[model samples]
Target: SDTLTDQQKKCVAPNVYSLAQAYLNSEQAWPRAIYLGETPIGFIMLDIDPEDIDKKENAYYLWRFMIARDYQGKGYGKKALDLIIDKCKEDQKSVLYTSCDMEEEMPYRFYMNYGFTDTGVFDDDEKVLKLQLI
Candidate 1:
């Protein structure tokens, strides 16, 4: 939480607090801390909602992701994302979904560069994006 600035915090929720709330609310949410060696650097969450199970395409959402301000631009975010994609592939997931505030420059561009395409879907004012894993 202290890794982000006030502006960044506004764009993304505090990781520790959000993770606690997510776990308390649903067993489907999986949260993980991003670590480099022994140092904590960021956080990510993946969710597989019941509604997602009903979809024709099998996918999981990249529910939340944030790299610390100091850690940004160091290639850690990209490497972490690659690991997440690999995990989904191992689980036989064909697609990975995520949504980000359109106004948030970092996440919007980062996801795009990482091959997530806009899906023309929105949730709570955020633009949805999807990556085809297969």
Candidate 2:
């Protein structure tokens, strides 16, 4: 349960911050543990009701996502994202939004490869990306 910059390893906030935010925003959060067999490899949290959060419109938001360094580049992230998308579709959501830093360690390209397009907006300094789920 590391904070935002645990050991200066990754750009994304660690599970501790994400999960804590999820707990505090329980009414709109949908946090899940990404597992490999029985072992937890990463964490993802979605703001299912984004309009209630920082979003200005009604949509789903990819609040936080990260896989441990040892588990990176092994298809775990893609699989976890697929599951997140499926969950949103299941709930009748049409759009999903997320933002990422321009830094090399960020998931910008990862999300782009998954069909997320830049919204030409910024959530703080993070560039916003969006995907259509419907």
Against the true structure, candidate 2 reaches a TM-score of 0.86
| lDDT (tens digit, per residue) of candidate 2 on 69-106 | 77888898999999888888887777889988878745
Task: Point to the candidate with the largest TM-score.
Answer: 1
26-123, model 1: which lDDT tens digit per residue?
77787888999999899988886635444668888888888988999999999999999988999898999988887648678999999999989888
Alpha-carbon lDDT, every model:
0.84, 0.80
lDDT of 2: 0.80
For candidate 1, the per-residue lDDT at 128 reads 83
- Taking the candidates one at a time, how many backbone clashes does each contain? 0, 0
Identify the candidate with maximal lDDT.
1
